[model samples]
Each structure stands twice: as C-alpha cells, then as structure tokens.
Target: MVFNRKHIENLILVTVLTTFSGQIYLSPTGGTFRLSMAVAVLTVALIHFRKLPVMLVCGTVAVTIPLFRSVVDYFSVLDADFGDIFRSYLPVVSFYISYGFLFLLLSIREKLSHPLSFILSLWLCDSFSNILEFSLRQLISPANIVSDVLIQIILMGLARSVLTYFLYNTTLYYIERYDRSYQENRYREMIMFISSLKSELFFLQKSIVDIENTMKDSYDLYRHLESGPQKEQVLSIAKNIHEIKKDYYRVASGLEKVLSAEEDRSSLSSREIFDLIRENYQKLSTNRQLHIHFEFHCRTPFVTAEYYPLISVLNNLIINAVEAIQQYGRIVVEGRLEGSIYRFSVTDNGQGIRPEDLELLFIPGYSTKYDTVTGRMSTGIGLCHAQEIVENHFGGNIHAESDPELGRTTFCVMIPFDRLQEVFIP
Candidate 1:
C-alpha cells in the first residue's frame, strides 16, 4: 500500500476535506463547493483504488442526497412548498453522481483524451430514461414508482455496457501501439551494449597477448645460459615470467569463452543455459558478485532450442540481474512447465525499478544510472536482447514485475516446449 502513490494522495485529499468541512458549509458558494468535493472524491477514488467498481459504488452512495434533490426540484416532484425545490432537484443529483462515477471509472481503465464523449453518452442515457418515464406517465397513471425506476436503471446499465466495450478496445489498441515503440527502442540499446562489451573484451585480449609474447622471449633467453649467480637470477626471472604468462593465458581464455558464447547466441537449450551462466560468472569475480538459484519443477526431457542463442537469453538476463543489484545481491532463477508451456523466471533483490521508470525499463539508452558509475559502457542491451530472444527466437513471452521498496524484481519467460523441441530436432 505504501508503494502506491495514488492511494496516498487520495488519503491526504480526504483528510484536508474533512478539516475544512465546516468552513465549506458556511461559505456563500458552499452548495457548489460541496458538489465539487463530491466530484473530487469520486476522481480520487477511481484513480487510486485498484478496485474501481467498488469505489464507484461508494461514490454513488455519498452523492445520492444531492442527486436525488437535483431531479426532484427540476420536475417539481415534491409538494410546491419551501423545501420543495431541493426535493425536485434530487434526481439530477443522483444522475450526476452515477454519471460521474461511471465516466471516471471508464476514463482510468480505458484512457481517453477528453470526457466530452463520455458526458454526452450519459446525457443521452438520462434523456432516454426521462422519455421512458414521460411515456409511462401518459399511458398509465396507476403504475408504481418502483417499476419505473427499475426500467430506467436497466436501460442505463445497457447503454453503459455498449460504451464500455468500444472504449476498452480503443484503450487496448493504444497500449499495444505504445508497447511496440518501447520494444524497438530497447532493441537498439541492447545491440549497442553488446557491441561495447565485445570491444572491451577485444582490447583486454590484445593486452594479454602482448604480455604473453614478452614472456616467451624472456624464456628463450633464460634457456641458453651458463651455470653461475647470473644463472640463478635468470632462472628466478624465468619462473616469474612463466607465472605471468600463465595468468595472461587465463585472462585470454576467459575472453575466448565470452567471444565463443557470443557466436550463434540464438540457439541454446535448458542445460546449456546453466553451463553458460556458470562459465561466464565464474570468470568475472573481480568487480561483481553473482548468485544463481535455479529450480526445475517439470520432470520432462529438456526442451531444445538454437543452443547458443538460448545461452544468450539466460546470459543476458543473469548479467542484467547482477548489474541491477550494483552490489552484493542474489539472483534467483526458477523453471517450470504448465502442460506444454515452459516458464523460466529470474528474480533479483536490488534497488528495483521505480514506478515512473517501469514503463521505460525496456527502452533503449534510458538508463537511470550515471554513466560514470556504470562505466558509461553499458548499452542496456542485455534485457532488450533477452526480450527479443524470448519473443522472436523461441516464440515466447517475457514480462517483468518489480517492487522498488522491497528492492526486488522478477522477469517471467513463457515458451512453448513442444514446438521448440520439434524445431531443434528437425
């Protein structure tokens, strides 16, 4: 609840309103002010609460008195007396409450540029209801008020349903369109990151190779010496150079592994994924700490894929998860199957993605980190590549859920096991 800002803002607004209630009542424009308060409350409730329908219901109840009076005054429903105007206006108050609540609910769940169309629709519904009432009064003066109200309610509900259907589809279309742009930007970022990492590895390899050649020359000189104090010094120097060469060889070996893994990264399978992660993280112990917890919940044969590419998927995810933590942190990996669908998840306990940041998390070059801190080298390609591998390579889906306060985030990947295996075998 604390992580939700919308809810917190709603609470603060409600508290301030409570404190100023008396002042509002005494003001000349108090009646209008109260109506404004009613609208404000409904908007706050709709935006803040996930249970929008329930909030809408509460808003309806709170404004019932004013709405009922609004209609009563308009129709002269009550006996023509001192308080009769307020009574006649009651129905308008009710209409306003119901109409505002529904409009707010639709606007939030289904994004709209303006409330004009929604307001127009409500007006149409109210007009239709009034027409029905006027028609009933003319045809049958003996009819009960309960039956009339029920008919009006049913008709208005149907109109709301029709409008909701149209609005919902429009919102979904806009969301999907926005997501596509997000993915394209993410792809560009990931590609740039991969390129930079490749270049860094190449430079390290060249340096190590230069050191290796110097050591080889020194060893050759030491091999041709006579026995003396100089011989002993030469021997010691030779040993030292051997050790240095060995260390250089090790670094070169690690670089070779990174490069090899990069080759044909589009193909990899379940067990290969484990091997790739283990091998990569095993070498990078100087600057980063990586912890992997893998769970296998399905007792089935390994699903096959393009071996290297699949490795890239796991490799990219693990790297990003580690980087996100920025310090000592754990990366939890889990795998399972639901019928023929395979699910793989990686979770990290880190400074999780912020709410505003979440929408652009996958976008390219949109890092929240300072370039110096992250070495200005990260192209943010890992996640975008991971997403691509899941969706395009394996025909799967990838999604992320995060809680910044808890410092935790999880990425879920769903793939069709049978189809992937068939492609691999074929």
Candidate 2:
C-alpha cells in the first residue's frame, strides 16, 4: 500500500498475469481488441483497490461484457458470431470468477496485503490441468477455436507467473537494502554530534586552566611590592583568589571523564571484578538500597576484555534491574568459563516483560518506562545501544529470559576468547 519497491513489483506481477488472459482469441481483430480492453481495465482497477472486497468488484465489473457486447452487435459493426464468441470466452470468465472468490477468502482470513500473488500462482498451476483437458478433447473430436485458444492462454499464463516470481523477489531485496542504508547514515550522524560535544568540553577545561595560571602570576608580582599598609589587603585578595582557583580545579578534576568509566590496564581477575562491584554497591546514595550478589567460578588467570566497558555494561544492567524492582529484591551476577568462552549472566527479581513487548525491547527509541505523574513519554535507546555494543563491538551474544507474572528476568552474555579479533573500531 505504501508503494515500496516490493509493493511496486507485486503490482507489476498482477499486471503481467492479467495481460496473459487477453491472449485468448476468437479469430477476429475486433473481438480480440474488445476482450483485451476489458481485462486491462479490470487489472488497473484491481491494482488501485487492493483488498478482499475489491476482488468481488472485479467479478461484478466482468458482467459488463454481456451487456456491452449485445449493444455492439445491434450496429453490425463486428464480423463474428457474437453468441459463439461469448461462449468461447465462457471458460475464462468462469476461471476469473473462481480466482476472485478464492483470493477474497484467503485475503480476509490471512489478513494479507497482497494475497493475489499466491492466488495467481495457484491459478497458473491450473494450466497443466487445462492442457490435459484440451488434449483429451482434441483426441476425441476435431479441435475447435475455443480448445486451441484455451491451451495457448493457459501456457502463456504459466510463463507470466514464472516471470512474476523473479521480478517480485528482486524488488523486495532492493527495498530492504535501501531501508538499512538510511538507518546506518542516521546512526553515524548521531555519533558525530556526541563526539563534537566531547571536543567542546575538552577546550572549556583548557581555558579554565589558563585563567588559574594568569591569576597566580598576578598574585606573585603583588607580593614583591615595597612595604606598604595596602600589602595586607593585597595578601587577603591574593589568598581569596588562590582558594577560588583551588576549588575550581578540584571540581574540574572530579568531573574529568565523568561520562566514561575508569579504565584499568591490567586484565581483571574474578576476585578483582567482584571487589569492584562491592565497592560500587557501598558507594550508592542513601535513597537507593540495591542488594548485589555474585557467583563467579572462573579459574582462568585473567580475561582479555578491558575492565571499564565490562564494568559499564554490568553497572547499567544492575541500575536498570534495580529501577524495575518496585521494592527491595536481589540482583545476581554470575560468571563461568567453558572451553575458550566466558559466560556472564545477570538475574533480577523485578518487573519482567509482557509476551507482546519482547520483540520491541531492543528497538531504538522504544521504551516501556512511564512518567510518574503525567505517565507520558520515554525514549528507550539505552538497552538498544548496550546490546549493539556487546554484539557488534565485543563480538559477544546477549539474550533475555523474562517472566512477567513471577517478576523475574535474566540476561545472559557469552564472550569467546576470539573476541580480541573484534577490537577494531568501525
């Protein structure tokens, strides 16, 4: 309906199949032209009104042939037996009616957007049946125009259907490819905006450092002034400026790399990772009481992954798990090593997922969080980006298992030793 590449192809396939119906002839130019015009008009109308009800409309419109053909005969303009010509096309008319009924039923029951593709395919298969019937009739008696034309029409219909298959699939491929390209471009633009903001913050810090150094030089020169009563006032002013500079430097240093987690050069042992988790748990504000527990069984010396991203992923997962819990509950983090792979799992006793909402969880800009007062909107890009990092950047896999009724959920991630190969940034 949106006329995407796939939809356009479906339209073309329908047009081709409809055109095949016009190849059946009654021996004269006028009769063939009239029949072709009727089928062509019907095909155009069907393309516009693509719904179950439209199929019935096509059959009703076909009834115009009898009424209009009678009027044409009154003028004696055409040179064929009108009655024989009508009977000759009666099989095609019956086939069209049956096709409409079958297609309408399937469309309504399946809620399909383009049901005619399958129906047209099935109808084309009837060509072989039509061919066999024509052969048996010709063996018993002399072949008539109706039988000969029916065989040819059936063969043409089969060929058209085969062509439809190739065209439709190719169109769908291009449509999906275009959709992915547009999305990737948008993602790159967003990353560029974030990087620019980081550069600005870095420059602002440098300017603050310069101002502090200038104030220090001014204070040092004032201290060397010859003995005078205003010396104390100058000393007090200088001290005040020095204290202000100290406070500014303290605040700026605390904020250094606030948006990112601390990086550790040494590979993290299981004990070190557990200690870091406990330290973070104790440092949480008084308003939140998050009970963190872990069960690490890995005997490996050290893992290849950096500590911060691993910690950041776990930190965010814990925070979200805590938020989802309406009351106090346990959050479990477990780690294990199997062969050359490391597996980490987090489990929470929190509000879980709805069956229908599962598929949408990892989609960018889709969130289930509701505002406390207005219950309005939230952009759910956090989990989406986190999953992207784990899968695309870390070459690991993450899976969620949730139970809404029981108020429990578990997220599992598996990282192979070969994840070092995924270190390159894109």
Candidate 3:
C-alpha cells in the first residue's frame, strides 16, 4: 500500500520505540543481546518512512543509547577504567553510524514494499554494521580480530533477519484490524444520527401546520372587532396571538435545521434552496430586530443534489454573518456556474473575523460568540457542521477571506457539477 507523510512519521516513531524496548546488553563481548531487533525495526520503517526520517531516527537512537548507558553505569557498582569504558562504547557508536549509511544505500537501490526486498535490505545493512563494529573492536583490542569472532557475527546477522521477518508482519496485521474497526464505528454513528433526524422532521411539520392555521383565525377575529369599551381586551388578545406566532415560527425554523442534517435525496432548484434559507433567516432577523439584507443570483436554477445540506450550509453562513454585526449589516449570497463547478458565496459587512482566528473558525466546538452575563459559548458547531456537509457529502470545498479594518468577510464554496450529475442521473 502507498504511505502518506503522516503514516511515514508514525512508522519512524514506532521503530524508535521498539528499538529502545528490545535492547539487551550481552556481557564479556559488550554486544547487545537483540541487536537483530534494530534490523527488523529498520526493515519495517524503510517500508513506510522516507530516508530522511529514517536517518534522523538512527541519529537520535545513536545519541540516546550512549546517554542511557551513562545513566545506567553511574547507578551500577561496576568498576572500570575510563579507557575501558570508552573502548566498549566505540563499537556501538561505529555500528549505529554504519547501520544508518548502509540502510540509506539499500533503500535507494531497492523497493521495500515486498517482504523479500525488505528482508534482503535489512540483512545487507545489519551485516555491514556488524562487520564495521567487529573491525572497530579489533582496533581497540588486538586479540579481538579472530576467526571465531567473525563466524559469530555472521551467524547472529542471519538469526536477526529471520526473527525480524516474523515480528514485523505480526505487528502489521493487528494495526490494520484496529483501524478497520474504528472506521466502521464512525460510519454507524452517522447512520444513526440521520435516522433520528427523519423522525423529528415528521412531527415538526405537523405542528407547524396547526400553528399557522390558529394564527390566521386570530388575525381574522382581530380585524372584525369593533372600536368600543371591549376594544382594549380584543387588542390584548391580538398581541398575544402575534407573540405566539413568532415563537412557533422560531420553533419550526429550528426543526428545519435538524431536518437539514439528513441527506436530501430530492432534485431541488437553486432558487428553491435559496428561498427556503432567506425565509428562515428573514423571520429570525425580524424577531431579533436586526437589519440584514440577502440577495441570490443563480442563472441555472435546477440541480440534482441534497437540498437540506446545501441549504444548511448557506443558512449557517448567513447566521454567522448576522451574528458578526453588533448592530446592523448586509448579507449577500450569490450562486453561479463556472465550467464544471457550482460556486456559491456569502458576503457580509460586519465585524470581520480576526486574522488569527480565521484559520480556526471551522474547527469543531470553536466559537467567537459568548454570553455577556453567563460567559458561555452561544453556538460552537455551526461552521464545523457546514464544512463537513459541503466537503464530505457534496464533494465541495469552502474558504473564507476577511478584512477586519473594513468589517467585511466573504465565504465561498465550490462543488464539482460531476458529483451532482452522478446523484441525479442514477
């Protein structure tokens, strides 16, 4: 499989940790017990990580080993001369440097994806590092360069290669299984959320219809009342009716937002989607006493797509624009077709986003609005949810540009027409 930069970095980190864990010091010869484990770790790392990180990890391990040994020796009661201690460390230093360069060379020459290629690369590097360490030891002590020592190095190299081959594959198997389970759980949660949204929409639509009828009757009775002593009472009742109507409208609008979370499987015109958003926001602005203007321009109106998500994204942008303005501002929405992409933009004249905060706006649970009295976030998921719907469901991308000095911000979304075509045609 192809590996990305993140995957490569993880592999390097894993190799470094495994190397530290597998270390075992052999007495008398001053060699490490599982030096072959480093070969196995390097083999796995080369398959995933790039040469740069591999080299860096090797350098890190080389430095860390000496420091670790120093700490251990300081605490232990092993009495040895400074010269002997330095002599013992020489072979380790030589082995690490040789391993790094030899691994780099083998990686450049071979494709490490296949097991055989990885094994061959690992064996070649391990053998060379071991030979270099043995030669270094010979220089440190004349009697160390014997036939018996050479044979032991060759035999150890073969054993390490065989051990690494088995261990790496076993570890890879468990990692893949864990990742697969995580993805499946995430998918299930999304499905359940959509199902719950559908049930809520049905009840909300029924309640909205009933409230609208009641509001119409109240208006008719208020208009027919005569101006007399009972006129004040009729007026009071009329005011209560208006207040109730506004409250129900607010409730209906909120329900529509919940409905928008589900996938819209119908073919809806761009105008239809825009009108729905405008009507919803108009009620909100009227209730809140905020002056906001909305404009939509779309030449090609009909498009086959999920209506709820599209409207939801536009609705969120408009809400954010409205909230940005402390007193009053204008919001303009424009939709146009350019080549094979549908471009939609929401532009506003409000307190524009801070330069530092602009990049973090779409992150989940991040909000700029806070209640003055309670010091709590007003809403945190608006932009995050909008971004997910556009990019994940509609195969689109969204970006924002802001001028804080002028109090102007514009958010733009671009979705490929091909994605819409696929849904509509099939």
Choose the strongest candidate by lDDT: 3
lDDT of each: 0.54, 0.54, 0.67
Model number with the top TM-score: 3
Candidate 1 structure quality by residue, lDDT tens digits, 77-196: 445553545543334344444554555444543433445554454445444433443334335333345455455545544544444445445655787899997875564345334544
Residue 188, model 2, lDDT: 37
Q: Candidate 2, after superposition: displacement of residue 295 in Å?
A: 6.4
Give me the overall lDDT of model 2: 0.54
For each candidate in turn, the TM-score is 0.35, 0.35, 0.50
Q: Candidate 2 vs. truth: CA RMSD?
A: 22.1
Q: Over the stretch 70-159, how does candidate 3's per-residue lDDT look in tens digits?
A: 555545636745454544664666677778787777763355357677666667777778778767666766554367666666767776
**How much RMSD separates candidate 3 from the native structure?**
20.7
The pairs that clash in candidate 2 are: none
